[model samples]
Target: MKIVTKRDRVSLRRRVDQGTEEQRAIVQSILDDVKANGDKAVLAYTEKFDAVQLEDYKVTKEEMEDAFASVDGEFVEILEEAAANIRSFHQKQSSQSWFDTSEDGTVLGQKITPLEAAGVYVPGGTAAYPSSVFMNVIPAQVAGVERVVMVTPPGKDGKVPDGVLLAAHILGVADVYKVGGAQAIAALAYGTETVPAVDKITGPGNVFVALAKREVFGDVDIDMIAGPSEIAVLADDTAKAHEVAADLLSQAEHDARSSSVLVTTSQALAENVQTEVEDQLKSLPREDIARRSVEDYGMIIVCDTWEEAIETVNEIAPEHLEVITADPIQELGKIKHAGAIFLGPYSSEPVGDYFAGPNHVLPTNGTARFSSPLNVDDFVKKSSVISYSAQALQKNVDKIARFARLEGLEAHARAVETRKERWK
Candidate 1:
């Protein structure tokens, strides 16, 4: 970690990775093949990329039972508790159909409808993330979606990870598929012979998956195109050096492009955390990845005041923000941008990632400025309802026609005019 005393030297923005033309071309070919050939293309790509041939891609009930049996009792208990917390949190975000009736016999409101089906893509190329199963599937279930499908690549042995299966089983999501990469995304976007197409897709994946989602966005809705992970800690003199260093490293180990930054008013705290990060990096299991991340993107920015520190954090718009100041609560309202905020020393970043109720699928790469975390709302659609009474139409018809004609939309003006005479 590099420590800087000058405020002008701090920069945390990372370049978003939009895959190369070659990669884009490859993803497009796979999407087209899956769109045209459906199941056959998916199977061929699975054999080529995942190195496995499967006559059937769906995970059977027998396989689910085997996976459930493989997981220990204690881990199952933890997954249940996490699922309960996630369900409770997302249930609050669910909305109902609402209509506001006016005295003039006009009705207007919004109708909330859950999608018929939703797909969750879990990554299994490098490591299996059981937590992602809980984060993605639980929200869709809470939104009252009729069907929730999960897709994950099979291992070289042609079996999904036991932990991923256990998590889906606990959530009661039985439609699990043993496929991944852009091919799985295409299968989800366009219905295959076996895999069902979904109204929306959510979850994080590699560059190929991201590009696939981008290409099929118009035909079906998708969560934001996520980038690498990021964490920004705002601390003060009262904050402990070791705890802050540990929190920063939690995100640094996620990927080589991951960024961990600290902005503080205490010069001593900044210098201490810098040394502590270097010391702790020696012991991390993912030391090589974490070391490269910290070496290239990590920073310890020393600001002259708390205001400067807070402003710097807002500018970065990190995916995760930890406030470990003397008064974390007082600084909460000042934070205008962050996908998720973890306050105090005890609320480490990992708590939100796994056990805590908040959704871990958050916006990254400064997108927190405009986007938001995955929630029950992502699985549902909103339709605006309008019911115009005869009295209301008669009152506003001329105004509407004049406004439409002003825009040079003669047909729109006539459409309103024709309705006015019928109502009159």
Candidate 2:
């Protein structure tokens, strides 16, 4: 494991702080090819990378039917249950377009409108994620998106993952295609002959997929430029060392570069957790990945006070923060940054990742300072409403016109003044 003393540290930020330049070039190349060649380029990359041939890039109704039948009935029930939880949690975010009329006959309100279509990209390499389908699609559903489309790479055997297909069906996603990587994002951002365009895309993916999202931001909305998974556990001596170690390894198992950290005031607790991490690492199925992740990005910061522990957490701004100290709630109030806060021992990172009813496609790599977790707001747009009676118009029109003129936008000023005759 890598150890850094507080004094000798060159930078306090964690190992996942910045992006490597190599992935940037590949992403740029993919963006250019997709923009230039459209559907043809995307399909070609799909064939070469995924080793699958496609007569057409769009998913057919027959394929979806087969996907539903392939899965077990019990699993389907679970999917329904998970979807319900996700929907219920996100429903609180739902908003309406309303109008308020004043005595002066002025009507003003705000309009909440869903995007025409939202594209979700589920990772297709080495794993299948039905849970991700819930996290990404349910928010768009709650926001009343007209359509939620999905893109994922097919297996070498020319089939997409059953979990992905089943989740798509459960979430009412009509569109699915056999594509992945930067090319998939391009196809979604700018509609090709084969793939329909989308207004936004959301999900956790590899570096290539993340870079693709970053490049396509203006062309279409993206959730966040996600990085390797990370977690920081703020524990006191009262916390179980084994539980802390297990939670740390959970994130480390994600990728070789994923970060797992323990910030605590108890030196004895830190030592015990380190021992537990080694003992438990032997039994893990993905021990190699977890080991490398811990070696590369893991750390144990021993601080003197709980305040110091939280200060370190703010400095890191981890993607996930688990407050497992004596007073987890008090620590939560102190934490102003972090994409998601997992309170208490039971609220580990995996709970949020799997079934906690919160979206796991969180901001990473210090982006917690400015970004937020994926939610209904990501799929919806808000519009401000403004209406004024003659009396109200007369009261504010001059101020509006003058403000526009002050900004040298005469056209905007004239646009407001155009209605001046009625008020006069």
Candidate 3:
């Protein structure tokens, strides 16, 4: 990690990855093919990219049972507990349909409706993310979405990982499909024989998946285009060096582009953390990847004052923020932006990543400034409901007409006028 004595020299903003033209063209071609050919194109791409050919892309009930049986009982218990926690937290975020009526009998309200169906794309290949399964599906389920379809690439044996399958099984999400990449996204955006088109798609993927989400955004809703994982720790002299260093590397091992930064008021602590990060990096199993991430994007900045440290954190607006000060909660009000704020030493980032109730799918890069972490709201749609009684329409008809005509919308003006005349 690079150590900087001056806060002015620190810059943690990473350039967002918008796919290359070639990648974009490829994604468009795949989308076009999937739209036209449906499951045929999906299978072809699955075989080409994943090196597995399958007669059916959908996972069978037997497969689910087998996956559940294959995993040990203890781990399954853990997943169930985590799912319960996630469900409990997100249930609080669910909204109800509400209405209000006035003396004139104008009924106005907001109707909250969960999406008819939602697609969750879980990444597969070298690793399996059962955590992704829980984080993505449980919220949609809590929001009352009926159909939650899951898609992940098949392994060389043409089977979904047991852990991923078990997680979905625990959540009662049976519509698991053996597909992935941009083609999987296309299938979700546009319905196929095996996979149903969804109202919204939520999950993280590679460059191609990101570009596909960007391309198919209007056709179907999607979660934010997530960037690489990032963590910014706001620590002071009271923070332990080893614990802070370990938390930083947890994100660093995610990808070479992942960033780990520390902003602290104590220069001596900064130097100690710099040494701790180096010593800790040597032992990480993914040492090469973590080292590259720390060397390229990680930083340790020594700020002159606590205000400067807080200001620096807001500037970064990291995906995850850990405040490990003497009194971590006391600094909460000063934090203006962060996808997920982890307070104190025990409240590590991974705690929220797996077992904690908060959704792990957070806004990445500098988007935390304007965006938010994934929650129940992402799986539902809000429609404004308006019912104007005869008396109310009569009172506001002329004003409504004038306002519409002011914008040069003659049709809109006449539409309201016609309604008023009919009521009269």
Candidate 4:
């Protein structure tokens, strides 16, 4: 790992900060095609890219049943537990429609209404993340969203992941389709002959999927356009170097683009973690990805004090932050920017990503400065409602009429003025 001295490193975000425009153009074209041709375009892309032939895009009841049988009972039980935890946490975030009445007989307030439908895109071409199924669907269910439609790429034998199916079942998501990539996003944003259009789309995939979500955001509300995974650990001599190294590798294994950084006050701790990372990488399943990430993006900064480490952390605004220090809570108070903050040694990034109640779909690539993790708010919308009795309208009509006329909206002004005439 490269060592960055406080004097050497630039303010950090001096790094390459935006997606390639070429990628944006390619994804935009895919989204446009899907919007125009619907399911026909989606199926063609799936066959061309994923190499899966599909007679029908929709997964049958029989396929779901078969997927359930293929999975172990123990894994299914774990899914149930994770789903329960997710639902319990999101239930607290749920809001209800409310109204306020005045003495003048006016009733006005904002109403919180869940989207009629939500589309969840599960990327199946590269890897399966059953944990993501819990993250995307559970919040929607908690927000009282109706008709959750899910799409995933199929295997060579035309079978979806068993864990994905079981997770969908646990989250009360009945609709499943075999579609993937940007085309899948288009189908959800715009109605297809086979798949119904959704009011919102949520979940993570590759660059193509992220680009697709960005393209479809206005047409159908989307959770976020996620980038690469990242984890920043702020540690002191109190933290176990081995555990810190292992946690860093865990996130680095996500992809070569993924970043894992350690900011510590101890030069000895930094050196120990560097050695531990090499030793631990020998046994990891995705050692090549982790190794490449560590070589290129990973860094260990030996700072003068905890305050210097925190200053560096705030500048980075990493997607995941693990604060392993003498007092985790006290250190955490200094952190103002991070998608999610892991309190201590036991609360790793994967803990929140899988079993923990919080949503794992976090802001990545330094976006935590302004963005947030996916939540119940992503699935529900608020609308300001206004109503007034005769007396209330009579008193407010002149003001309303004047405001509209000031904006050169004659019809709007007339509408309010007419109400005043009726009130009289």
- Candidate 4: TM-score? 0.92
TM-score of 1: 0.97
Query: What would the per-residue lDDT of candidate 3 be over residues 1-424, giving only the tens digit for each residue?
Result: 8788553564665656898889999999999999999999999999999999999999999999999999999999999999999999999998999999999999999999999999999988668999999999999999999999999989999999999999999999989999999999999999999899999999999898999999999999999899999999999989999999999999999988999999998888888899999999888999999999999999998888888889889988999999998899999999999999999989999999999899999998889999988999998889999998988988998999999999999999998888755764
- The positional error of residue 81 in candidate 3, measured at the CA in angstroms, is 0.5
Candidate achieving the largest TM-score: 1
- Runs in model 4 deviating more than 4 A are 11-25, 396-424
Per-candidate alpha-carbon RMSD to the true structure: 1.3, 2.3, 1.5, 2.4
Residue 338 lDDT, candidate 1, scale 0-100: 100
TM-score of each: 0.97, 0.92, 0.97, 0.92
- 1-424: candidate 2 lDDT, tens digit per residue: 4434444334434444234688788888888998888888988898898998887877788888889999999998988888888888889877778999998889999898899999989898878999888899999989988988899988998788888899898877888988999899988898788788999988877778877888899989988777788998888988999999999999999888888888888888888888999999899999999999888788888876777777888988999999997778877779989999999987878887777688888888888999988988888898989877888877888899999999999999999899878744
Regions of candidate 1 where Cα sits further than 4 Å from its true position: 420-424
Estimate candidate 2's RMSD in Å: 2.3
Candidate 2 regions with alpha-carbon error over 4 angstroms: 2-26, 408-424
lDDT of 2 at 320: 92
